[model samples]
Target chain A: MKGFIDLHLRPNLEERVEIERIIKRAAELGYRAVGVSLPQEKLQERAREIRKICSDLDIDFISRIDLEPRNSLELLRSLRFLRRRVEVIAVKCLSKSVARQAAKDRRVDILSFSPIDLRRRFFDSAEAELASKTQVSLEFDMAPLLYLHGNQRINLLWKMRIETIIARKFDVPIVLSSGVSEAWLLRKPEDYASLGYLFGLDLENAKKAISENPKKIVERNRRKLSPNYVAPGIYVIRRGKDCPK
Target chain B: MPKIVRRRYIAVRIDSDQTIERKDFIRAVWSSILRLFGEYGASQTELKMIDYDPTKGLAVLRCSHKALPMIKASIPCITHIGASPVTIHVERVSGTLKALRRKLSI
Candidate 1:
């Protein structure tokens, strides 16, 4: 069975639902896993607590840290420190340099470029090539659509269409995140897929953004964090002396 | 002689705190389509609310086959109807309303 996972879901603040309640709702919504965004400070303590609750509910909960760095140096420092700690590392692109750097970094799992960001055109073919080469997925957050209306919404959609075209041209992985701050805002995976279609992704590619691409990032990072992992595509295993050579 | 227009029925399930009337629901969908795709695309859809159950929050909507993607694309764009917030989920789509109802057990 194909698993559906929402790669970005923030803790419900306005609704103030308990963490367990959020996990239960996500499960009911047919999500096999959900990535919960947490603050960078005290990440280890919070992740441990959330992981326990998710385990009891039989839902794969990924601890994600979202960073909005002011410069490339800050971004790299945060990435170096947090990569080993969290299951997913997402950097919000605030400048052209940061966007380009994040796209080329192997440690970065997701580069989030919102339509409301400062850059008129945040992503171009160059960044797309870097993203494709480094295996970093460009993220499109759906939260803006929840509030923006009329021409504002239309403009965001137009920008998204251009970004999608560039990403598709370079064959860069495109991932969709709801960026929901409230529990009710959490949408079903199929809805995200439909939204992807509006952004110019075909049905298959859109579905991949919601499922396969994110799953691959999680699995790859999980292996890299394992004790036996030496490097990418290399693992070390102890051989028993008693076994025939 | 005019050829028959191929139609598709989408089974939509509404998730909300309060029950929404069928009239209000159709109005919401039309306004959403208009907002997202503009007047020309809205006319092209030929959208209609075929059947709706307020209690269950399930509805089967009919649209031209070519406009199915446009309709699906617009479902998530509807954030609210009146003052009540709602989320629309497209459960299934089929060639006939009868087939959609049977598959969805509506």
Candidate 2:
């Protein structure tokens, strides 16, 4: 069965419902896995507890770090420090330069950009090409569509449509994330696909953006972080005496 | 006049904490579609609430075949109905209302 994964859900602990209840809600919504973002300091300890709840609910929990990099130096340092600790590393790029840099790095799984941040042409063809080349998926958050109203919503949708067009042109991998700060904000996978369709993706591509693409990212990152994995396409063969050299 | 309007029926399931009135739900859907697609696109859709069950939170909505994507695309934007947060999930889409009801068991 093709499992659906929400790769950018920020669950609010302060919500009326408990964290476990939120996880259960996600599971009930047909999400096989949910990537939860927490502060770097709280992630490790919180992830352990969250994982237990996720396991109980028969859902995979991914530890995600949402970083807002101010400069290249900070970006590199954060990547180095967090890459080994977290399952998913999503960087919210504040500038075109940072977006370009993040797209070129292998450690960065998702380069998340808010529609509000795209006041100018931040992601051009060059950045899209680099992202496609480096296999860094462009993350489009659905929170704005749910929260923003009137012109703000319209403008954000317009900006997202342009980004989607660019992503399609470059054949860049695009993943739709809820970016929900609360459990109630979580949406069904089909809902996310519908939003993706509005943002200029075809039905199949939109569905893939919410399911296959995100699943591939998680699977790829999991392998990359495994002890036997030396590098991309270079895994260790422990007992390969009979294998062709 | 000939029946030139090619229609499609979408089976939608509303997941919410509170019961949403059919009127409020229809209003939300129309507003969202209008907001996203504008007057011209909304005209193209010819959207209508064919049937609704508030208890089950299931509704069958009708729209032009050409504008089905736009309608489905706009459903997610109806995040709330009368201050109650809601999530609209498009369960199925069919050429006929009968088929949609049969498929969705509504």
Candidate 3:
């Protein structure tokens, strides 16, 4: 499985070299794909530039677009170019109304709800709004707000257990991300396993939460996924056809 | 000629008390002693112990050179091989090819 970082492209700072370097480093480290974190304002020009970069490097580029009206317009416009070149469009929906609109306007490879606030009152509503859609999926941010409440430190095991239970209940497809702000912070799969174990994550479910489900996003979008691919229950690159249940 | 790398060590620390059955005691500490020896380096330390038995309630650890520091740092509780209260010292030696290869490189 592969993972990526969001380049919070700051203005007036030359991002071309830095972005290229980051991509180069990622490729060297054996990442399967990369995603750009685009603010609503700069989607048009930057998407063009990123498309070019991805072409030159032969790496898959995914555009993570915010689901605000202003950003949606830019994303919708870029969808023409993106239809052929880009791998996936990650839409972070603030509201179900915007999500439905984006779904209707352009094909979103992945739909994620990254609400900064922790009320969770809106999740059922958001889930209901997109309940009918197929091919598009959801991701959990594991954000501090979601895991930790005021004056409380959340147990990682309990959180994983709960999320797995909830995901099963809703039959919703989910992906796990570190929500990392830096590049050097990439963690090993074993580390995630230990954490999952600490949080009551069964070995198979923990593997799926980090490795299988996230890879599904790329496999769903791309035409040429790697041959040595591992998926849910299937542990490739090893002797085992399936992880021991 | 390849330079010899420090591979393993053995520590047999003698402790007071000599009342309980020695063989069963050594069997019980076997797993813990091995685990502590393996975690000597970031990867596989690849250490091994030949034998630990009862002699005046003494504890003994046989491990690899790279694993020496870790073996040194660990509490004697793991290497304590006898039934009675005893201090154990670790003696280490160069491991076989399989062990060294497992420890070498990233």
Candidate 4:
């Protein structure tokens, strides 16, 4: 089996020091693959340098676009344009309408909340139901949990617990990420797996969130992007007796 | 029947721009545990700071085996000790301190 993957390393291109440190540190911490979230407009340009850095350390670099579409209409437009361009598409669900749209979109891989604002976490039972029918995974980031304190921290945990219960009930996959742009914020995979206990995930499911769930998301994207792909669980055979070519 | 006391040792590497003393590290870890798991979980952990090197930013901690997940969750929540930002990455965990020390060659 492949090693672990952290799907939300938000390394900014302007911060050269942070970009290098974040990628190198992730490699040292034992992540085999990482989905680097870049702004949609900057995706192609920013990927080159980050991909090179990751290759040096033998880390699989996955280009990811984090869409913060203002409305459902804007999300549809971005999904139409960016779906095939990036390996992973994570939507920053800031508003209720956007959250609902992102949750229901098959093109979207992860449904992420704002890191700084706890109020922006709009995930609930309705969103969970929308996400369950699709391939969308609810991302629970540990970065916010690290910095939030006192009552604010309690508030976020309570929200997370409720959302987690909802996700479990609807059978939506949950993906755990460091969700940190800084190198120092990066923790080992096992550490994040253990942190899963706080979110009401069992040990086995916690481990899977870090490894298997993310892996399946990437693999699903690859399969969809494959040239021979016809539809879900349907592919073309080029060399078989049933094949025309 | 006899009851067995299970213990685990964890080797952690601290990442920070400044040096962190053993006491501050302990305070941060303990505070995190209390904040997340409360006083009852704190008592059950049997948490102890066995060895610390301020210069190297390396430390070894001992805890009840059952509390391994508690230690793992608590340490990552410690983003700061006093005014300085810090992060602890667990490098290894073992049943015996000697085995952990051998693994780290310390």
Candidate 5:
């Protein structure tokens, strides 16, 4: 039942006060993790201030890459102070090229395919190839799914394809997130379980995607995720083992 | 596979060239059409029937037009004038709240 909320960090406009408010609220709400999106204009000092706030709270801090492809190295370099303070580096990959380039950086904790960018080009064949080459885990954001609901059948079809790719590929781990913006917009874990089941992720895998996997990401990156490493119990159901697909 | 309580249909003629396109088009229209047929189907407590084809440039859809407005509106454009079957399939899904209440009352 543990869930994470993306704080949608706005770098300017007195973010420390805003972030502290969210961190305290998140701690109260029993949220195990909080993700922050970096703005392109972020300076080294700004990253340090954010990192310090997260460290002080003993909350799991996840940094989502905010800069474009050309600025990725700079983004990585700027995030050095926050790296030891943050657990996961969430990158947006719009194309196979972007995904490949993002994959080159071992610092990236998760590679999420952007639906906005991948709408025209379905990730049917290319994504599988990329996953095979990278050995990096993939994540599907829920934002595009909502946006493309009535507009594109390809969007729905692509999600199905991506989930199928994750299952059959075996080498890559696929994580699912609602990519929530407003706290009230968070979907119940049961809701995701149904969608995952429909998309060929069995109950066990669905549970992992919802609960355990994020915890693992956070635990693995302890200094950034939190002051203490609290590894939760995980029940692994090997694909095609004990359950019929 | 479940016990079918209501039946309606959309019959479309399938031509070789545009079979897939016609099928996709009809299916895209099918969901909207069902909304128009909702009331009649609701009163009758029955399921729906759906069928369509592209080869003959015809679509036959069946559902209660009273309950669904969209279905009634979209049917005419794809309707076949000379086609013998003007039926639309209505499917009353099992375990619906209405069905559950009926069973509970009995």
Candidate 6:
């Protein structure tokens, strides 16, 4: 297995000690890279320090933003402004229009839902079909499973199972996140991959959800974010006449 | 004649806010397994804590080889020990206790 990546940690930057502990724990748990979701301003303010901490711990850092747009208009507006600025953009689909729009948008990297609310999940076959044609991946956060119990956990698993079926039917990609807003919620990558068995995913597909899918998203976005990026599949190596147009 | 059961040992590092007693840790794990897998599933695991160091929060657990994945899955479900939040990481797994201990020296 490749070095795993957990891509949806919401580390609170206000507590420097806490954030460092989380990053170190992530590295200790064998994550090659970790992505932290923050507001735009917080991300801008702390990207450097976060990067430094991760680097010292020998873990790669990614800047991610989660957009909870109420409507398609807001989703589109944020997509345009935030696309080039962050390594990963996950849209929490609150309404039908936002889900549809996010499913088809090229700039959106992940489509996430409220893990606790079945009604908030939006990855139907329709959404999966649209997402399959684009580069977007459906995100499954495991944090809620560790906390919720009884009916809530059952309902979330039921919804997740249905979403998994739809995603698999359309060949849409799926990514697993720890969804750790706090440090203690983190778990080993293998534990999570195994838990994917509770859903419709086989062990191999589940591992890919945490490893290959998220890695590809981050790597592709990194290429786009690079200074030499000219267009998709195009880059500028030399600036002089030697540069090929 | 009785049949011999193949067993595996899991070396885990417990990350918690306070030093944990071995009995409490094992009980918490049992509670978690019961919650997630129910009584029959818990019985199948044959879960046991072989060793624990309260000062270091390191321990070794024994379970049926076939139930390895079940043990791994249930560990994450144990989020707290009496309100002091905790997380456990499986450092390594081995067929023999000696090998597991040698590998863990963490």
Candidate 2, RMSD to the unseen true structure = 2.6
Q: TM-score, B chain, candidate 1? A: 0.95
- Candidate 6 local Cα displacement, residue A173, angstroms: 1.8
How large is the C-alpha RMSD of every model relative to the true structure? 2.1, 2.6, 17.0, 2.7, 15.6, 2.6
- Runs in model 5 deviating more than 4 A are A1-30, A40-59, A70-86, A119-135, A223-245, B1-106
Query: What is the Cα-based TM-score of model 1?
Result: 0.94
Clashing pairs in 6: none
Tens-place lDDT digits, model 6, residues A1-245: 25799998887778888889888888878799999887877557788788888889889999999999989999989988889889999999998899999999999999999877678787888899999999799999999989999889878888999999999999999999999877778899987987886676788999999899999999999989999899987888888888677
Per-residue CA lDDT of model 3 for B1-106, tens digit only, reads 9986655534343434554355555454444434433333424445444444455443334555654444443333332344333333332223544453344311
lDDT of 2 by residue, B1-106 (tens): 8877788988888988898888899999988888888898899988888889999889999888988889877888787888888888888999988887788765
Docking class of 2: medium
**Candidate number of the best DockQ:** 4
Sorted into a CAPRI-style docking class, model 4 comes out as medium
Best by TM-score: 1
Determine which window of 10 residues in candidate 5 chain A has minimal summed lDDT: A4-13
**Model 2 misses residue A108 by how many Å?**
0.8
Q: Interface RMSD of every candidate?
A: 1.2, 1.3, 16.2, 1.1, 16.1, 1.3
Candidate 1, residue A216: the lDDT equals: 89
**Tens digit of lDDT per residue, candidate 3, span A114-133?**
43333321335345335325
Superior by DockQ: candidate 1 or candidate 6? 1
Q: Which docking category, incorrect, acceptable, medium or high, applies to candidate 5? A: incorrect
Candidate 5 global TM-score: 0.50
Candidates arranged by DockQ, highest first:
4, 1, 2, 6, 5, 3
Candidate 1 chain A weakest lDDT stretch, 10 residues? A11-20
TM-score of each: 0.94, 0.92, 0.47, 0.90, 0.50, 0.90
